[model samples]
Target: LLEYLEKDSFTKDEILAIKTEDAGLTEHLEAIKQAYGFGYDSISELIEELEGYLKSLNERLDYYLNIDFDGRSVVGDDPDNLDDRDYGDNNVMPKNGSIHGTHVSGIIAAVRNNGLGSNGAANNVKIMAIRNTPNGDEYDKDVALGVYYAVDNGAKIINMSFGKSFSPHSDWVRDAIAYAAKKDVLIVAAAGNDSKNTDEGQYYPNDQIGVGEEVGDTFLKVGATTYDYGSGIISGFSNYGKSSVDVFAPGSRIYATVPDGKYRFLQGTSMASPLVAGIAALVLSQYPKLSAAELKQILMNSGLPVVKKVSLGDDAVVPFSELSKSGRLVNAYNALIMASKISR
Candidate 1:
């Protein structure tokens, strides 16, 4: 509240009036607090309560408000780019109304600061949209080609915002991930959207390459985050893994581009991956010489930690430290701080 007041135009008198109007404001604030923390008794009850709360909040919150970027027409229907590029069937073209890709694209680089939409985390970036992911599970060939295509076309960072729990030829995708790692291109992926721990064989395409105590430095699988920090450890439905999922970001109720030149609120690790990708883009943009491994270290090392203990599949609040590889949430502010030191 103090932070909000300092940044916004809320004068002393206006704030006084608000405080006066809501006699129980402090009481309510203390209850839900930082993350709308709840003390439910059962998982079903928790889901029931969270679903309604999230749905209602989605109607009002602009999930993409934080990232700085503007929308562009790469293929399907960007009015600004009048026939700039053909979105052929052979090549997965950008859908004018596909909200998911548009949102992810906006997060990566949507024409920074044009006085239109929000600015992307990175100031300088050239987003190459390879539309391989469809409504359902994506094909292994498509995903493989997507990674190779990005590498061949000079794409330093590839943001894969889609995945599935089942794949016929899983090795193909794994090899694609490996290929990206070998080529020195950073591949940030979404740890599926199941809200369960992927370490349990539940998380397909799971990043358990090294297993034991150390994970390979090539891939960074991310879980989605909600608005608050405390009891809101992970999204109500985000899959968690002790060592698989690297970190978390705001994926609760993201506001981003949609098909038909419109915008709306959508949820998934799909949304979170782009958020991280955009931040990585910013880091690379500032220090263009940083390798993919260096970039990943910067991200993990600079993230913000959640102090409050919270539950993972139940109401038993465990220390935030017990969650993922890094007990911290993705913090762009901290990332820049660390990146500056590294750049020097």
Candidate 2:
């Protein structure tokens, strides 16, 4: 980084080119400027600031990785205790300025026809913000409690766009799923971004007990799909399974909201889950009497069928139908039509 920055001077275009090379460096430079003044008087000053910033960033990263930095000590509750709901505050907003939840929320219910960013999938949707995820892996107890809170507070459709590979106490989550099912609430979860078959693996917060065994019919697992309708339709990063994942949804390069009242394009099953959730919300709004299980089935069965073989990852290809249980891409129009027919 020093070698790249070592120069007599830098033009605006050259600075922009350097910033484009790394997102972290760009943010660091912006932060430095915000702390100090706007423009640096000399290249040496800029280089000095960047060197210190890089050193601090590396040290912080090393500490985070090598040390067992536990933030739960401040929360004052044991992670093992599911009944200990006395911790946490009412701040359901994103912590540490994370835009993941913001992007997911916008994908579902951003204002329509306002010329702000883009039109969301659903119009008449009431979003309930649940801040359970931190910077890294979330706790199983928090996952359970978040679901319970959503269900109890009249959340008809819950979109969990986050997942981890390991969950020591997944039973808590599964029990929450059963509770949501009994209350007739639909859960839409991301299939994960691991680029592996979930049938042969496990993703946390899933409703499945085994490959073919599911706890309830209200759970829908969604895989990520690209805008391509051809062989490369399936996103290479998406996790898939014939029995695990329920459907595919557009996730690649999805434009939505970000932190600090901004908008940007992001890609993942995280983006896909909320898109599916929005579609589910649209269906449910029109047909309020439909059960969550029926809603799940309608979404799975009414998606757009893909007849072509698609790329999974690493030059590997499989029939699109084999990737997920439904073997179809979630379509809002088709879902609404199916819901109307079912309502009839």
Candidate 3:
């Protein structure tokens, strides 16, 4: 669990200080404390339980880091070959307590005003789960197919919150993106988590098919920003580029849903992408006639510009204008107002 928490971006001290309000966890901890107070046999039982948990976590870590590990045999498809498309099961829910996708989905369209957990950005949007990303890295073929699947299934807006450094079959993914654009389906993608500038680096699934030009106008690339609007506005881990990233949105310490009907705080450009997607969904809900390109334009043009100088990385301070193409932070209210005016 500690390893899992660390992988989920929790620090060591943060993990140690984590206090669960869950009745089961509280009860288990209390029982363990009582066992320590009782006798050596009771303490031994607690040690055994902790050892078992640690062993399981170690095994999970081994599998995650093992390059020779091949779980693809279960899917019965060639990951290298793009032609073999018909593979994998319908179990789209997070496998083995993986809540990254769930968190992103909840940020976009979790149930609102239900008196349950946190409210999502868009209330009436239906989240279509696409299990493309695995534990280690995402396959290019899976991403392309995920886009095609969403587009063919009548999805108006697609939120892709995952990205990688390399894409072997980028053409296939670009073709799929073009297909979605042709169908007027809007795609919102995360710029990346790497602190590097995407304009100088290669991030896959971008609208730019070649050097210095974009193939479509429907695709919007988003970078992460914090709620604080000042020198520390942009997230330290968020990728940025004046030519690549389109806009910024809240991604730092964002509280959202996890697996098993729970919620947690996660931070990344992954969180930021879904936020813009949610705003796009809200605009679409209000103005259904808006095309994908128009929606993208509305989002880019209707954001709140951050004029303050912000830290790009360690000791490097630059104006927010140089960070992204729009030089603006995404504003849902402003986007809605712009959509209303455009609809008129």
Best by lDDT: 2
Q: Which one is best on TM-score? A: 2
Residue-level lDDT tens digits of model 3 in 1-344: 33434564433344345578878666755664555443223444446545744664465465544577776778798878888977887887654746678889899898998987888899788888778876645677888999999999999999988787777788888888899999999999999888989888888877674347777779999999876779988888899998989999998868799888887666788899999999899899989999999999999999999888999776799999999889999999999999989984
lDDT of each: 0.67, 0.84, 0.82
Q: Write the per-residue lDDT of candidate 1 for residues 15-99, one digit (tens) a residue.
A: 4344434546665344433232433333344455467446534532332221232222333433233223344356446443255
Cα TM-score per model: 0.70, 0.81, 0.80
* Candidate 1 ranges with C-alpha deviation above 4 Å: 1-90, 94-97, 209-216
Which residue runs does candidate 2 get wrong by more than 4 Å? 1-67
Over 4 Å off, model 3 = 1-69, 209-211
Residue 53 local lDDT, model 2: 44
**Candidate 3: minimum summed lDDT over ten consecutive residues — where?**
36-45
Which candidate, 2 or 3, would have the higher TM-score against the true structure?
2
Worst 10 residues of 1 by lDDT: 63-72
